[model samples]
Target: GLGDHPTVLYLGKLSRLEGSELLKGIIEEVLESVPNAMFLIVGDGPARESVERFVEQQGLSERVVFTGWVPHSRVADYIIAADICLLPRRHTSFSPYTSPENILKAGEYMALGKPVVAPKMGGFADAEFPVIPAEPEEMAQAVVEFLRNPRQVPEFQRPTWEVSHARLQRVYSAIGAVSR
Candidate 1:
């Protein structure tokens, strides 16, 4: 049982680009403000072992819950259980132009009425939702602030797949018109 502990969730692959290192730092900072905070990492990848080691090294084993690999069907359960969703991708050379495929994950979290704390990079920078910085201190502050007033988090109206498909069609139509 999660009990009354405030849970911060990350529901994507545990890779280096996912900012596992920064997450550790943010966890330490968040603990200062939220002593009983729990981080629910709900995916597994090549970087899982290293992240686990880092958690242990930082003496954060008890606070961070690593769920390894969960079935896709069960992802929503974890999201529903979270108080906040985290997207801590660190900015890099590829971040400026490359949009992560996982941008949809932010929409999912928002659809569930969960506030997301993501770095302002790549797709996040262009996102309609609110975003914090990728810096550890800023992430920690955002998390603490959200916890203090969860209701203040902005409302996000997630577009349906059909709406997205129609928008793509419109874009293609305009591109064809220009290329003629």
Candidate 2:
């Protein structure tokens, strides 16, 4: 069962854009701090096979579990199973305007009161989401801190994922990105 280990979950695309390639270093660092840490990596993309090969090479087969891909309806189960959630992707230059609001899984994780460690780029920059926005290299420390002292995340209301009509008018009038 997952009860015996500190489970860290990464639920999203496994592409380089998503920082999936950096998972190897993050995993190795996390294990150094918390030897019994278990990683539950979900989703699949171009980098999945390469990431899997690294895991096997390091003989972390028992410590890490990859679920390939699961249906959207089942994401909550994985989020609930984790001790901590991670937004492994650090840079989002390709999509500079990507909004964190589009990350449906983030709302799910925070709604379940999971402490998410996301990078301060893309949509996550300056956003008021209830997550820990730490650099990707510093992620291991953030994960270890939470595992050592679990805390209830502040109440997070799931956003309606809608653009308010009033807000749109404000942006049009200002001719700039809106902030509120």
Candidate 3:
């Protein structure tokens, strides 16, 4: 779960699906729309080096923070520390199966009462948060709105992991019954 921040943020690797190139443009647009905006990027991947080069090339070296790949245990702390949480994976059918844990993490963020912004797609359809399509302009605008008025996003509801385990138990039982 990414934490909500007063600053505009883009976390995660620049995978082809995540649209890393659009982030720089979106950040530029967001800054233009909202003053006092900042951008933080976490994680490293095949595109990390390229993204760093691009950030330098675009002269955004000062405006963006790159943390490289932090350990998984430390990810939650970073999310909790931010003002807004961002999960900008591209929308795809495979998203549900591949990224359901992310939606769950978004719920964790919500439980902590942080506003989350994610692309509306598989795995997240059932999860909570302000889901939106994967578009930089729209994302930029959403970041501006969230920053301008953080309270606008409703309170988050963090369910206990035990409850989730129970729900999964029922689901698995139902599946087993059907198979039987």
Candidate of highest lDDT: 2
**Deviation from native of the Cα of residue 75 in model 2, angstroms:** 0.9
For candidate 2, list the clashing residue pairs, or say none.
none
What local lDDT does model 2 show for residue 36?
86
List pairs with backbone clashes in candidate 1.
none
User: Which residue ranges in model 2 land beyond 4 Å of their true spot?
Assistant: 97-102, 126-129, 155-180
Give the per-residue lDDT of model 2 (tens digit) for 1-180: 178898999887787877776788888778778888899998898989988898898888889999988998898899989988888765555655444643666767877767788776666666653677777788778788877777766542433334345556677769756544
Prediction-by-prediction clash tally: 0, 0, 11
Top of the candidates by TM-score: 2
Q: Return the lDDT, model 3, position 2.
A: 28
The 10-residue segment with the lowest total lDDT in model 2: 155-164
> Distance from true position, residue 64, model 3, in Å?
0.9
Residue 118 displacement (Å), model 3 = 0.9
C-alpha positional error of residue 164 in candidate 2 after TM-score superposition, expressed in Å:
15
> After superposition, which runs of candidate 3 have C-alpha atoms over 4 Å from their true positions?
1-5, 92-98, 123-137, 152-156, 161-180
**Which sections of candidate 1 miss by over 4 Å?**
126-137, 152-180
Q: How well is each residue in 119-140 modelled by candidate 1, as lDDT tens digits?
A: 7666565554444444544887
> Where does the lowest 10-residue lDDT sum fall in candidate 1?
128-137
**Per-residue lDDT over 28-86 for candidate 3, one digit per residue giving the tens place of the 0 to 100 score:** 76666765556677787777787788778777677667898888777766665667767
